[model samples]
Target chain A: MTSILASAEELTGGVCCGASVAVPREASGCAMEAVRALVRRRVRDLTLIAVPQAGFQADLLIGAGCVRQVEAAAVTLGEHGSAPRFRAAVSAGTVEIRDSTCPAIHAGLQAAEKGVPFMPMRGILGSDLALHRDDWHTIENPYGENDPILLLPAITPDVSLFHAPRADREGNVWVGVNRELLTMAHASRETLVTVEAISDESLTSDVRLAAGTIPSLYVSAIAEAPRGAAPVGLPGYYDEDTSHLRRYAELAQTEEGFDRYLAEQVIAAPAPA
Target chain B: MSEAYRPEELLMSVVAGLLEGARHVAVGAISPIPAGGALLARERAAGRMRVSILGSERHTFFTDGGRELFDCAAQGRIDAFFLDGAQIDGSANINLVGIGSYPRSRVRFAGSFGSAYLYFLVPRVILVAHEHSRRTLVDRVDFVSAPGTSPPGVYRPGGPVALVTDRCVFGFDRAAGRFSLSSAHPGQSVGAIRDKTGFEFTLDDAVATTAVPGAAALALLRGSVREALQEAYPEFAEHVLGQAA
Candidate 1:
């Protein structure tokens, strides 16, 4: 029974080698290369957890028919425009939407980080977001007067995915100020990271770098993928490719156009296994 | 007339005026105009004012992820912030979620980013809506992303102080639970505002025309402020400030 119940690496995926399952990040490098790899692999029925916000990653996943459900704050393209594929899927009722706010998602992630059931947060008192979300609850503050605040349940995703500037051969990933990536790694069962480059030296060699580094203990896999956050841009590496983003946005507005975009750019040629 | 300025330029100046002596001003994501205004305010303060535009590397001071903004607001560190809405009511209730009912809606705007939390914590929330018609301004919103006022005993340090629209400016009175017309732009008329507005608001006995941006303000906006704004909003810098998009 113990043998039947236990498979050591099964829970962790052994190493991160899959296509479409988990949604990627936006701020802490969106893992665009990983996303493209997933698109190529044509993985399906994904339950993506985009911490607070997501953009091209979500849109691409949705457009590629990989996402079944999305738990996110919002999926937008910022100044470019609304997320065409996400909007279409939600409107058509093809994908399940679990609308969340930034703080709520953070609180939920924090709860998972703390190994707690839930965390109470201020605000969301009279907002429609609170009204719609059943997973979130309003509770009386135990310490103070009849104060009611929102309590967000812990969100422990099956896998955490992100792109970082660099990773060491030791599997330690350097995430600088992107603390949410660290939290995501801590809370999730497994973290799969793609990096611009795998450093020869250990990231923990320097004290400053070590302070912002997520140890290999939490990271399940580190894939060397240069320009991993293309179009979206890594904070230090490059600026967002707005021209490409604009082109994608324009092409993604219509179903035929989006399909064409996927055929021409995303899945035109399969990613290397 | 000392060479006309664009409505956006005038509006940005008005927003900067509202940020008169703000120690720390934060502009939310997707808000280029407000961000530009905040940059102008920082310029006016001669580096005294700190403006944090979300999603910008140079602007934000938060290193601890997204929660720092909320923490700062709750701790009263944030002096001013900007919130936009698909629909805003007379009571200052802003609806950013969507049109029609909840969960399911006819149209969904971008989900409430941090309005619900920041509206309760920040001291001054300046509402900016590009469209100032009956459709945008409502007697009541289809959804309340963040209520402008809270019941007594509720810990609310922040609320709507004023709203700037394409046509006019309206100052909100939190105690009175209503908005009062502050000023209209040069060509905009009180009758036009009243006709276009969906919600009922108090009209001041002497509603002045919104002041146009002077040569100095224009220079600052087109020069330094615009340059700084390019980091966060490149399109805005190009569109409004005539910088390369």
Candidate 2:
């Protein structure tokens, strides 16, 4: 049930299921392209939860003319009808990015990492900001103080696509201390590792990486893409594109505008908008 | 006597009017003046006033013994805000996008981080500006970073309780949310504020700027802010002058 490769063979097949899996080593150069290929092929669905970062940088997606629509469930905007002039959207034209930080997936990953059922959080208890989102809210606590803390059901992505710094033949990978990355990697059904460089030795060979934020067992396919977070982040070497950030911030100002952005950036356009 | 005031004097004076009665306020991401003013208010007012600085970056090292102020808004603790606008029209529609037409505009500002979100929710929002020019005081913002109006009864509706600028002070008509000139800084003419804005204003009789900082208040502001910033960001002392303790 795995599409991992022995050489440059890319894991291009859709999600697979199995008790044990073996993915391609990072020596393969098709990791990022495979994830992008999946998106280009329109494979992943809403049920597939993405992480805090890693995957398409939302801003770049907006500028690329791929967004399609926006669905805003847990955000601050339009109490009555359509969203106002400013507010993140539910479905941008090409893809849909949740309005705020995905504390749910993060918390869930944390819980998963800690081997727990749920994580409690504050701030969503009193408001009906995101209506159909019971998956993120828990109104029960005997003490009932932080009652509305999100349960953050474990993320368990259909596939976890992440860019790392390096990897070895056995699929051991190394990356910067990407805050929520381990959460996404651990909680996903499958893990796709995209590294910046491939080391001849197993990643476990590096003492720094041995501390184990992302244990090797969690990854499936490890491909090398040199600069996966390019134009967005390159940890230690460069900073994110600030102007790109400003542009995304500008587009995310309104529901309609954000939707237009999704269409323009994420979607392959029924025809590129 | 008021006629002798210069621009910077008018600025401090105008700021006083905007902050006159506020007890709790919020300042959100990416604004330097509003962020700085909210800090100034808390320092100057002490425990009598509470100001929450919300930077979208959600991290802070303060200027006055203050904890890093980040993620306060996400937690829903903010009460009021000091909002800034790039292009403010008569109705106070703020435009941060750019000047003129979309593709061919003059100045394009970083759009709102969450002004609209906070505007609708925060009990009071005070629009602060250092640049009170016609270009800035427009009739409407090129874009509505946040709306000035809110619905009745809902907690997050209604907007912009007050608008403060270097030229004058404005308050909204509770019902209309339109900006009304409540007071003018020393030497500022109603005509001047009106000329700067795109809409006509509900002007009140001339009022002098808030009195100059008393010797004690001035010394306290300088000392406390300096101490706070220094302690809050021990490393930035060189950048902040001797403000660090």
Q: Identify the leading candidate in terms of lDDT.
A: 1
Per residue, candidate 1 scores C-alpha lDDT tens digits across B1-245 of 46567777888999999999999999988788898888888898987999988979998889998777877887899999999889999999998767776555667665677788888888899999899988999999998888989888777878899999999999999999899999999989999999999999998789999988998889889999888988878777888898421
- Candidate 2, position A218, lDDT: 79
Compute the lDDT of residue A166 as modeled in candidate 1: 84
Determine the TM-score of chain B of model 1: 0.97
TM-score of each: 0.92, 0.49
List per-prediction Cα lDDT, in the order shown: 0.81, 0.47
Q: Residue by residue across B1-245, what tens digits does model 2's lDDT show? A: 22332343334334544665566665543343454445566666657766554322222323211111223444445556666767666665554434554423344333333453455545566777767787677765654555565344334432566777776777777576576677776567767766766676775464545454444444443455435544323333224323321
Per-model root-mean-square deviation over C-alphas: 4.1, 11.1
For model 1 chain A, the run of ten residues with the poorest summed lDDT = A1-10
- The TM-score measured for candidate 1 stands at 0.92
Count of clashes in candidate 1: 1
Worst 10 residues of 2 chain B by lDDT: B61-70
